[model samples]
Target: MPVYKAPVEDTMFVLYDVLKMESYGNLPGFSDAPRDLVEAVVSEGAKFCEEVIQPLNVVGDEIGCKRNEDGSVTTPPGFKDAYKQYCEGGWLSLAFDPAYGGQGLPVTVNAIVGEFLSSANLAWGMYPGLTQGAMAALHVHANDEIKSLYLPKMATGQWTGTMNLTEPHCGTDLGMLRTKAVPNGDGSYRISGQKIFISAGEHDMSDNIIHLVLARIEGAPQGTKGISLFVVPKFIPGADGEAGKRNPVSCGKIEEKMGIHGNATCVMNYDEATGWLVGQENKGLNAMFVMMNEARMSVGIQGLSQSEVAYQNAVAYAKDRIQGRSLSGPKSPEKQADPIIVHPDVRRTLMSIRAINEAGRALVLWTALQADVSHRSEDAAERQKAEDHMGLMTPIVKGVLTDLGFDNAVKAQQMYGGHGYISEWGMSQFVRDARITMIYEGANGIQALDLVGRKLGAHGGRAVMAFFNEVGTFCAQSKDDAALAPFVGSLSKGLKDLQAATMWFMQNALAKPDNAGAGSTPYMHLFGLVAMGFMWGRMAKAAQDKLAEGADERMTAKLATARFFFEQLMPESSVYLARVTAGADSMMALPAEAF
Candidate 1:
């Protein structure tokens, strides 16, 4: 079994030391998250996930979920018990609104807990994870009656949730979905359709499953414009808002997937299920986007989660496994050979994984804080800026982190040689699970397109310009700090590269369009490198401050790792720039008949 120790200390470093969580005390709900309290909550959450949930990871993969003759699904043993404990622990309400039976904490604090759970056991963690997204969507778009009907139970984890959008015919193109909803003449509609690849779609863990679905109404205009969002529960709520009669929703079949075997990714069949519209007529895509964006962020965490676990196991293996003599003289002369850690190549691999994981953690946490500011800030201007930043960074976080995360998992598996390829070591599972993050939640290709296509010019280029200004200001401030010169210098150059790439697209893409499409992926990755570089600079400055204050070995280690990131990892941005600048000619050269 792969061991997973909760990274509580690393999380605290980002939360308090790097981001300064204390300064946000003035915001509503943040006042309750004092350092000691946040630490205690994170510690307790970590203990629960590590002890109660993590052991089920292998079991879930092996046993998977079973479908019965009655069409109900059964999860792996202990999943239900673990979910019960999670609900009783009040975790579902941790970051929700108090008006709906929640504890009303900051989303940033909740995100830390979320990362830990995901790292410990991603498949099991997904049950509550999907519910969190559903709650977020309903909280924003659902009417009062709908909120009253669903939010309370969902907030307490008594009911779980799922998003139903994809059909056999459609994945990314929502305009092609065939799910239908016809008005029943009583302020409700009858939803009828089949949806495939619905994660957490069918399970016996909760009393009811609230599905936020997308379907077209009768005689509406074609495409996504005619689509509408609906809330259709597995069991219809009675006048008292408890699960009553059965709704017409049923699981057609559970997908036999490459990973996340514990989650019931189902093919769902809805037969005239009772449903209510969420946002507005002919605007379901808008309401559904709220849930999609939230899920994308969660998917990005899934990327980081896999990398962290893979890195931990790889570190352990490198220390224990005996290998050839060190290139430098062998320090462990008592043994026949030195440990793999002594090898420069092994060190390079470990450092590469570590550099990305640490910096990725910082980037996600910073964005989570931005989400908090977007939702909690008193100043309208501050909220708008934070919202714009969140919109701009979302695709990069989802795209880059998952792509790197899968690569990191493969590298970790490489460290184990033959054992990594085998099943018992658990490294293969991490890679398989991380694979879906890049595909779902808007495939990384689409994410790249979104970055180049929509986010750059959003609000008259305010978001990207804001990013440039922040990096420039930081580089300027650290010019005099000799200890921080490497990180600042690398990040400054990265910013310039990113700017040049953006300008290239502006100069060439509008007329050709194909030029933009060809370069989107590279440009997305370039943006991600710069974002991670900026984060590393912030972490380096924090580490430097700690060292100046006569801190311990950990601070020294942090500074060294930051230096490794600047020296080894940040240079990849240049390659991405070169690709982006190459444009579409070579990519589109071949004729369709050539294949």
Candidate 2:
């Protein structure tokens, strides 16, 4: 069985030491989340994930979700019970509004919880994850009446939620969607549509499911402009706000997916479901993007979560599995042969995964802090800058983390040799689960395009420019510190590469849009490298500061890992930059019939 132990200490270090989260105590939720409280929450969360959630991972994968003849679905065994425990523990309400029955903690704290949940049981995680995303959308865009009726129930996990966007004919192209909503001559609309790939769409865990669906109102304009969002619950609430009547929405079937079998990815059929508008008419995409963005961030963490678990298992295997003697000599002379970890190639792979996982966690937390700032800060300028950071980093987090996360999983599996391919070892599940993160919540390619095509130029490039300035400032400040010289120097070079790539896109992509399309993926990764390198620099500085006060092995290991990141991973920025500037000629040269 695969084992997952949440890196609670590392998370604490990043939260308090590197990010200095307590310094923002003036913020709404931050005031409630002191260091001790946050530590207790994370530590308890870690224990819950390790002891309760993780044991069911293989069981969930093995049994998957089952759909019954009544159009209702049953999740994997132990999932429903585990989900109940999760709700009673108040995990879902950690970062939500206190007015809505939430604990009112910092979003950064919730983000840490999210990583733990995902790492422990990703399939089980989606059930609540989708609900949180839906609640966020409703909180932001839904009318007061809707929020009052739904947010509290969803907050406490009495009612879960799902986002319904993709139809049978459409995935990314919302304009092509044909779902229609006809006015019922009252406050409600009659919705009729079929949405596929709906995660946590139908299950027995919650009393009701709140589906945030995208549909076009009758007589509305065509294309995406006509799109509008609707709150279609499985059971419509009565005057007293209780689930009184069964709505016409039902699960058609659950998808036979590549992985995450424990999650009920359903084909939902809506037969004139009674629904209410979420925001304004013809502004569905605007409203749904809120949830999409939230989901994208969570999906990015999913990537890291899988990679972290996979790395842990691989490390355990490396230490125990005896293969051959170390090239330097017999390190374990008493044994038949040395452990696989003694080999240089094995060390290289483990270090590579460790380096990225550490930096990736930091990046996730840092970006999540920006989210807290964007939502909670009182200053208008601070909010705008933080919002810009969220917009700019969202795609990078979603794209780069998943892309590398899957690669890391594969590398971790490679450590197990042929056993990794077998189901009993559990490494295969990690690779399979990690694979979906790259494809869902907008594919990595779309994420890259969003970065290069939209986010990069939004608000006249304010976000990217701000990122450049912040990283450049860090590099400049740390240049003179001999201890941080290597980290700062590597980060500086990576930042320049990102800047040059941005310049290339500005200069070349407009003349030939294909150039932008061709270069966008590399640009996203290039941006990710610099962002992670920046994180490493900060972490190195923190480690050095801790060491100055007193020496510690943990801090020392942190420095070593940061060095590995700088030496090995940061240089990839140049390779991606090369790809970014290579242009689209050869890539697009092949004619339609060439294949």
Candidate 3:
């Protein structure tokens, strides 16, 4: 079995030292989340996940989930007991409103807890992970009665939740959906349709499953404009607010997927299930986006989680597995062969992944703090600025992290050679599980397009411009500091490349939109490199300050990783910039019939 020790100390370093988290003390949740409290929460969370959740990862993969004759699904053994303990621990309500029986903590704190759980067991984590999105949607759009009836239970994990959107005919194009909802006499709608690939769609873990579904109301506007959102529960709530008779909804089947088999990706059937409308009529997409956006960010964390675990295992293997004599010399003369960690090529691979994992963790935590500011900050201007940064970083977080995460998984697996191919070593499971993150929660290709097509220009490019200014200011401020010169210089060059790519898109994409389409993925990656470089710059500055204050060996290690990122990883932005400038000519030149 694979071993997982949660990166709690690293998380604290990013939260407290690098980001200066205490600065947000005035915020609602931050005031309560003092350093000691935050550390205690993460430490406890790490213990729970490492002890309770991780043991089920390989078991979940092997046994998976099963569908019974009654259309109900059964998860792997110990899942239900684990979930019960999880809910009893109040793990589900850490970041929610205290009025809803939550701890009233910041999303950043919840995000940290989520990282530990995901790293330990991603498939098992999806059950509660999807519920958070569902709760966010209902909290934002659902009416008071819906909130009163569902939000509290959902928050406490007594009733789990799901987002039901995709059908067999549609995934990305919501305008093509065929699901239908007809108004019943007493202010309720009858939702009747099938939703496919619904993660955590059907399970016996909770008392009730509250499904936030999307369907078109009768005679509404055509296409996406006609769509409406609905809250359809597996068991309808009675007047006393408990689950009553079973509703008409049922799971038709579960998807036999390449990974995350533990999560029952169900094909659901709704036969005129009693449902309540959420948000406004003909504005379903707007409401559904709340869940999608949250899911997208959560999915990005999944990528980071897998990368962390893979890197841990790879580092362990590289140290213990003796391969050949070190190129420098036989340092371990008593042994027949030196460990692979001594090899230059092996070090390169390990350092590359280490750089991405650390920087990626910083990026995710930084973005999570931005999310907290967007939601909890008192100043309207501050909230708007944080929201802008959040929008700009979301796609990059989802795309770059998952893409590089999968790559790292493969690289880590390579470190194990043939053992990685077998099941007992458990490396292959990490590769398999990591692959789905790139495909789901809005595929990475779609994420790239969103970065170039939507987010770059949202709010008249205020967000992207804000991002540029932040990077520019950091680079400028650090230019004179000799200890920080390496990171600052690399970041300066990366910012220029990002700006040039943005200008190229502005200059060439309007007249020939294919130019934008063809370059979108590369531009997304370029933007991601700049983002990661900015994070590394911040980390390096913190490391420098800590070293000046006589911190410890960890500070030195942090400096080394930050240097590796600047020297080895950040330069790739220029290559992507080159590709972005190349435009659509070569890609578009081929005739449709040529191949």
Candidate 4:
């Protein structure tokens, strides 16, 4: 009843033409990678997701995940086999280093591959995607012996990984966390904590589930500074690398949720589990962020994936379903009515989704490029700038794109009219699944607070300023490029609007502390919109330059997409600018007792 086709052309355009990611091929660690390999991998990956993984979408959501009384969780009817297929196809380690049985692909290409995989079946796709994040964290923080023990199998996908940070009483505020760990003198700790909302927590899809958990050590500091990370497995591995004995890890229950029914969200109980410290003692929270950043970016891909699937379904429905007369008179008199696509509002909705998705895709891909630069650049200053850009852009990737992705989903459902609300159309699933994105991975509101309260003040806001200056320099270099004028003009306006909103928020937050919280979400989104618009404009500039030197029709399609983005999506900033500049009075006027 539903269909999705990977936007392979668009993906190629973003990877090769827009970001020009292969430019990094000259960098020391990345010298082995170039455009041809990038193209070959993404193309093959897209086809694999389309033919193998996507066929499982409906099956996954319908079958969901079931919990057994014996502390184990069963994945959707065929998830075990599907994930096995995924792992066997070498997808699990596409971006990992080659030393651990991975392909050592550039992360930029991996991001595109992730987008396609998720678009096909996000519910099932989340399993490996989240595991990749866990693997990355442990790889960064785990000691050599522990890494040798777990990383190889997890990277190869014989085993999987899960994150355990949230508990029943705590969601975003880790400061109130009650998870505890006690030292066991022989270079290990015993971890005991109840973690809620653990995705892929205790599933039977892998030989074992490796859990990277957060808990406070004995006599640790009272707040966030005391939190430490531990590696706790479901079953202890014997000398033969098999899970021989059941560990003290078990699932209390699986959450019954609105969407992502295919993926298990568990309430986990860790009872004095044997644990190994991944990083420095009492500095675990800082170490775990290695995984958190990766998780947050993957969540951003989920947002885009959700948007792409919803857009595809809605577009198909609009083209085929004919119930209304044309507004410009009778365009379909032979049939009794016209297709919904003939209507202006329907056109607007579809265009909005298309534009946001395309712009959002560009922003996401560019960030991935920066992420590669942060890790692989040869020069120290270049690496520092890349790291700064990655830090500043991470929240936007998580906060703004996801927010728009959900909006696109809602518009998609609206496009289907009442049919969208009914489960069979499958439109509702997009909205429901996308909702969790806003709440988790540090709620978008919190991301804004970090942007203004922390990142903005980081390095004296010079990181963000460098970002703005780069955008300005790009515009200056491209003003003479004829085909890019419209996108550049719109982007220039959006940038000014964002700059104004930033100045207003800075003044307000200084004058009144409450102003920061009240303006947080709006400010975050405003920044996100302007940031994406900047990317879109750069895309137009690149496409225009290529055209001046001579490109084919495919390049024209990009120009058209750039035009559509400027005309439609950039206007969103006006709305957020007002909300951001609204001051604290509007939000704080209501007393706590009024409710």
Candidate 5:
């Protein structure tokens, strides 16, 4: 069984002490939500996750979901009621708007809550996880009429939401999707196509399912510009805002994925499905990106959440399992054998995983904060800067978190030696579940290219400069904090390496377009690792300050984890930089005929 003790104390400290979330209340609509309210919400949410959903992790893994020939999907037993608890508790709408029945909590609060839910059961958690994306799309692109119709049920969890983007032949290449939509006599369109890998596409937990789909109109152009987004429901809504007549949409089949078995992955075959356009025709691709961004960040959090859970379970196992004597001394000779944590190599593995997990958590929270500022800030310059920061941070959130998250799971599994390979220990499940995070919501390789090829050059290089300036400012401010000297020094050098990589790309992008594609992925990781290291440095400083103030013992424990991160985690930059600087020669040299 995967044991998970909610890290609520650390979560509260990070939100209140490190980020000072109370200041967010002054940012317009949040005047009513105080620190007490936020803390209460977090506490209750944590408790619910630890109790209700955490037990389902292995149950869902072992039992998985069943897909019958009738095209209906079944989640693990008890998932429906557990999902009902989530709905009744109002988790789906925690951070959404109030007019739509949401509680309108801070996004940062949602981040912490989501980490708990996802860590408890990534597969079962994905049902609501995906609904949030569809809800986000409706939130962003749905008109007043559509929003009034759909947002409430989704908010109340009466209806679940899903984004149907992938097709039979297309994965990340949205431009090649063959889905088609024809205008009906009324305002609606008739959609016909096949969509694959649609998670929570067809589930039994909700009364209705709303699908945010992408399909091309007749005579539309041949690429992404030709694609448009539509709201296609499994059943048409009644005037009273409930499920009525059956819509034309149906689940053709469910995918046999290697993991996330409790979440249905559907092969949806739409035959003249009644649909409503979200934005303008042919401009749907751009509009859908709003949901994609929200989904991307959520998926990244999935990785981080899984890693954190993996660490929790791994730590429990390491303490209880005694295999050999301590190399330094017989510290635990009182027992039958020694704790694995006493082994230097095992400590290094655990510490390295800890360092990355902590940094990843901070980075996600910080990014959420930036997003909050971008949307809620009163000052124009502040809003613009926050938007720029978000643009730079998206790839990092999606790319870095997933990459390191998967690595953390593998490392945690490695700590168990042979048992890690066995499913009974539950460590292998973490590794298996973590794999999908990298592949879905846009593959990590594509994310890397986006960072180097697009985000760095966005706004004519100003975004990149803004990012560097923030790092530079942090370094300058921390000059007096000698404890951060090692981390800051490593961070500063990594910053320069990123800058060099950017300059190299800018200089060669046009003359050598292949260079960008060849070096993009490695360069993305190099930059993401540095960004996580930077965030960890900030977290370490905050923890150390608490120690200086004579705080709780948890503060000292956190400080030690931070110290381990700086010493063990910051050394991988050299290897990534080496691979990136090797450039397009090797990748390009393997010609079309070579295969």
Candidate 6:
């Protein structure tokens, strides 16, 4: 069986030392999340994930979700009980508003806990993850009555939520969607549509499911401009705000997916479901973007979560599996053969995964902190900058992390040799689960295009420029420190590569749009490299400071991993830069039907 231990200590280090989260105590939620309280919450969360949720991972995958004749779905065994425990423990309410029965902690805390939940059991994690995304959207876009009716129950996990956007014909192209909503005589509307690939769409765990569906109002303009969002619950609430009547929305079928079998990825059919419009009549895309962005971030963490669990299992196997003797001579003379970990190639692979996982954790936390700042900060300039950071980093995080995450899972699986391909070892599940992250939440390709085609130039390039300046400033400040020289120097070079790629896009993309399209993936990856490189530099500085105060093996290991990242992984930035500047001539040279 695969084992997953949440990196709680590393998470704390990133929170308290690297990100300096407590320093923002003046922020609304930060003051409530003192070091001790945060530690306790995360530690308890970690314990629950390890002891309760992780053991069911293989079970969930084996049984998957089942759809009944009544059009209701049941999650894998133990999931319902585990989910109940999760809600009762107040995990879902950690970062929500106190007014809505939440703990009112920093969003960062919730994100950290989310990583643990994902690593433990991704299929189970999706149950609450989608709900969190829904709450975020409703909190931001839904009217007061809607929020009052839904947010509190959703906050406490008494209700779960799902986003309904992709139809049978539309995935990324919302303009092509044909779902229609007709105005009801009173305040609500009648929604009729079919949405596919809806995670946690229908399940027995929650009292009711709140689905945020995107549909066009009757007589509305054509295409995406006419689209609007609606809140369609599985059971409509009565005046007392309790589930009273069953809505017309029902699960058509659960998708037999590549992985995450425990999650009910349903084909939902709505037969004139009673719904209320969220936000404006024709501004559905804008309103849904809130949930989509939230989901995208969570999906990015799913990538990291799978990679982390896979790495942990691979490392355990490496230490125990005996193979040929070490090249450096007999390290274990008494044994018939040395452990596979003695091999240089194996060490290299492990180091590579470790390096990225550490830096990736830092990157996630840092970005999450930006989310908190954007939401909570009182200053307009600070809020704008934070929002810019989120807009700029979202695509990179979603694209690059998932791309690398799948790659790392494959690498870790390779450590098991032939056994890796087998189901019993559990590595296959990680590989399979990690695969969806790259494809879902606006596939990695779309994420890249969003970065290049929209986000890079958004607000007259303010976000990208700010990112460059912040990285450059970090490099400049750390240049003189010999301890951080390597990381800072590598980060500086990576930043230059990213900057050059941006310039290339600006210069060439307008003349040939295909150039931007072709280069966007590499540019997103290049940006991720620099962002992670920046993380390594900051982490290295923190490690050095800790070492200066006292001796610590953990700090030593951190420095080594940061060095590995700088020496080995950071060099990939140049390759992506090369790809970014290669232009689209050759890529687009092939004509239609040439293949």
Q: Compute the lDDT of residue 167 as modeled in candidate 3.
A: 90
User: Positional deviation of 436 in candidate 5, in angstroms?
Assistant: 0.4
What would the per-residue lDDT of candidate 6 be over residues 482-512, giving only the tens digit for each residue? 8788788888888988888999999999999
In Å, residue 42's CA in model 4 sits off its true spot by 1.0
lDDT by residue (tens digit), candidate 2, 153-228: 9999999999999998889989999999999999899999899999999999999999999999999999999999
- Poorest 10 consecutive residues by lDDT, candidate 4: 26-35
lDDT of 3 by residue, 20-92 (tens): 9999999998888899999999999999999999999999999999999999999999899999999999999
Q: How do the predictions measure up, each by TM-score?
A: 0.99, 0.99, 0.99, 0.97, 0.97, 0.99
Alpha-carbon runs more than 4 Å astray in model 2: none
Ten-residue segment with the worst summed lDDT in candidate 3?
Answer: 96-105
Summing lDDT over every window of 10 consecutive residues in candidate 6, give the lowest-scoring window: 482-491
**Local distance difference test scores for all models:** 0.93, 0.94, 0.92, 0.84, 0.84, 0.93
lDDT of 2: 0.94
Q: Write the residue-wise lDDT of candidate 5 on 1-595 in tens digits.
A: 7777766777777776777777777775457668788789889998999999989888888887777787788889889999999998988888888889988877777888888888888898888878877888788877888999999999999999989999979999999999999999799999999999998889899999999999999999999989999999888999888899998788877777788877888889899999999978898877788878887888889899888989988888888889889977887879988988888888888887777777787788888888888888899998998898888888778877888889999999988889999988899888889899998888988888888778887889888798788888998888677787877887777777777777777787668888888888878887777788777667778888888898888877777887676666666677776776677888888769988
Residue 576's lDDT in candidate 3: 95
Over 4 Å off, model 5: none
Clashes of 5: 0
Reference-based TM-score, model 5: 0.97
**Model 4 whole-model lDDT (C-alpha atoms):** 0.84
Q: Pick the candidate with the highest lDDT.
A: 2
Query: Which residues of candidate 6, in runs, are more than 4 Å off?
Result: none
The per-residue C-alpha lDDT of model 3 at residue 179 equals 88
Between candidates 2 and 4, name the one with more favorable TM-score. Answer: 2
lDDT (tens digit, per residue) of candidate 4 on 279-338? 888888887899889988888888988999999999999999998798789778999899
Q: After superposition, how far is residue 583 of candidate 5 from its true place, in Å?
A: 1.1
